[model samples]
Target: MANPSRVFAAVLPAAGRGFAGNEKEQVLEVHTVNRQSPGDRVREVQVTGTAEVCFPADRVSVCVSLGNSKESVAEVLSSVSRRLEYILQTLRQHGVSDKDTVVRRYLHRAADLYHMDAEVVATFSDFEKMEQVCSVLLEKLDKSVCVGTPQFYHSAGCLSQLRRQVCVSAVENAQQKASEVSQLLGQSLGPPLVVREEETKEWRNEDGEFGSRGQGAALLSHLPHRPTITASSRVSVSFSLRDKSRKQL
Candidate 1:
């Protein structure tokens, strides 16, 4: 039976609507469907096609966190604050500005030793600046303020633009795919009956992860930046079949 629900959100609460045993009923229905024999299978499924397009990021947001531990919270924060100030200086020297940077987090945790963790972030004029920033931190932050490295991001405006561009490209890609399939089947592409969307997340500065140091700790050589960012999307679209005698959907 076709689900009357229009959206995924609608389906979730559909069974929960002011019922005493709604969850149990839903479980039973799910089990019943699982046990039911295979009814109709669409062997020739027209997968809604997917298209990917990459757009250069105009601005990048990054988060750089620093942490250290001593005794008192004041001592911890003061140590971190100095390192952070130096980092800001390094970035500014390389053409990055305070306006392009923002402080993200400042917190203290009770550990074996006194500790301070700070999250300072900056947007680069160019992505290459990120490399220099990291390098400077690795070199300058010696025996103090353990650097957690920087995280990369794209602004919402950039993401929104890509979504629109990718969506249009996806629709065209679907049409081309359906047309090819139709031709191979000795038919013409019928007007599309249904369209759906799928997307994959990706990162802005896909540059490889920040370099790492070998095993064994020497002040600040054990922490490695685990940079895993991938943006990908998949779409599936199907066109209805129509003959000269049949009307288009």
Candidate 2:
């Protein structure tokens, strides 16, 4: 009787079916046989495939703040309100919807003076518009207002899509590998017997800050090291094999 393990191992290429790399792509073939009877033998090939996908940060949030102090509460409120309203109006005029803006105010009396501080945080999907809005606020408000640096990050929907894309790519890679191995063994590829995602990982760039000023400063800041997120998937697939000679008969 033939040794099933040796027979299976010798059928596939020693170099494996796909290109080898640093965990970016991997392929391994596995075979199992049923020894219940020689005529009842079952053969299958299993391969592991890996893939990675990267995406840049899609959303940015900028905070604008102003404060004032006066001997009376009414004076402090009046002074702070003027700048706060101006900031809100500027955001709206730049096509920023109310739902994307958050407003917060704080009031307290320190010794003899009443102090008021207000902040407006706006989220933007359009980078160009964000840059324009930031420039307008900083130029008009001058030293009286503070516009914070832009913070970039990916949205939940973007992350969801990335995961789906990486997984599908990994599966396709596995199928390709299986087909190649099957052809090399003088057999035809059949329907998948099993498909599973073995592992998944995600990471982001270490430096997430973009600080510079220029014509395309907003877009340029992402160069060299943008705040990008990468997702990787490892999938295991098992495909049945059909003998060409038997199928022809």
User: TM-scores of the models, in the given order?
Assistant: 0.41, 0.74
Q: Kindly report the root-mean-square deviation of model 2 from the true structure over all alpha carbons.
A: 17.2
**What's each prediction's clash count?**
10, 0
Give the best candidate by TM-score.
2
**Which ten residues in a row are the worst by lDDT in model 1?**
28-37
| Candidate 1 lDDT, 28-107, residue by residue in tens | 22212223223333224275667666655455556667777777778877878887888788888989877887875556
Q: Which stretches of candidate 2 lie over 4 Å from their true place?
A: 1-42, 208-225, 245-249
Worst 10 residues of 2 by lDDT: 5-14
Best by lDDT: 2
Please provide, for model 2 over 41-114, each residue's C-alpha lDDT reduced to its tens digit, 9 standing for 90 to 100: 66789999999998888888999989999999999999999989999998999999999999999999999999
